[model samples]
Target: MARILIVDDAKFMRVTLSNILQKGDHEIVGEAENGTQAIQLFEELSPDLVTMDITMPEMNGLDALKAIKNKAPQAKIIMCSAMGQQKMVVEAIEAGAKDFIVKPFEESRVLEAINRVLG
Candidate 1:
């Protein structure tokens, strides 16, 4: 299992994702409540992967993804967002996010996405 970083503004989202990934035997290196924190944590922890939310306070996920990719081009990031944000999803992909996971998350889908990214 890969070490993962969960970056999202919502506490419930972080908790939910953490619980789900933990069950897969993944180590959660750390969590970030905002994009800035996410970048900092990434630099420090250098987790194998990161699950970043698109709409976050302080700095958005797309920008943070760019920053992370800039600093670590090999970094793997998956964007998690709600439905109907096609434009943002495209932008996130352009910014170097490996994949996107629609929100109101399903456990199976989330796991599948994680496996795809980690695989």
Candidate 2:
């Protein structure tokens, strides 16, 4: 199982993702509320993967995705977004995000994206 970092401003979202990941037998290495924390935690935790929310307080997911990629080109990041964030999602993918999961997550899709990215 992969070691993952969950990044989201909403506590419930983080918890939900954490639960799903735990049930999938992946270990949660860290959780960050925004891009700044995500970057720091990424350095400290070096998790195998990161699930990053698109809209956040301090920094958005697309920016964080780019930042993390700058730090570690091989970093595996997956952007999480709500319904109308297609443009940002496309930008994130171009910036080096391995994949993305739409908000109000589906367990199967979440697992599928992670499996494909980590495969």
Candidate 3:
């Protein structure tokens, strides 16, 4: 299992994601409510991976992803987004995100994305 950091604006979404990742034996190193916080946490904790939301206040996930990748090029990240965000997902992939997962979460998809990125 890997250490993971989860970044999302929704409290329930964060909890749901944390629960799922925890069950897989991944230790949650930290959580962030927005992208700025995520970037800060990422620098401080340097977890094995991060699950980042696409939309957030005070700095979107894509911006944070760029910031993180710029500083730590080896960092592994999975973008979390909703349907109809294909363009942003493509941008994230171009910016070095390892993979992505759609919201209104499915357990299998989430797990699959995690494993694929981490593997």
Question: Clash pairs of candidate 3?
Answer: none
Candidate 2: lDDT of 85? Answer: 93
User: Tens digits of per-residue lDDT for model 3 on 6-107?
Assistant: 999999999999999988889999999998999999999999999999999999999999999999999999999999999999999999999999998898
For model 1, residues 5-99, the per-residue Cα lDDT tens digits are: 99999999999999999988898999999999999999999999999999999999999999999999999999999999889999999888999
TM-score ranking from best candidate downward:
2, 3, 1
lDDT by residue (tens digit), candidate 2, 14-85: 999999999999999999999999999999999999999999999888888899999899999999999999
Stretches > 4 Å off in candidate 2: none
Q: Pick the candidate with the highest TM-score.
A: 2
**How high is each candidate's TM-score?**
0.97, 0.98, 0.98
The total of clashing pairs for model 1 equals 0
Off by over 4 Å in 3: none
Per-residue lDDT, model 2, residue 10, is 99
Candidate 2 lands at a TM-score of 0.98
After best superposition, candidate 1 residue 117: deviation in angstroms? Answer: 0.9
Q: What's the TM for model 3?
A: 0.98
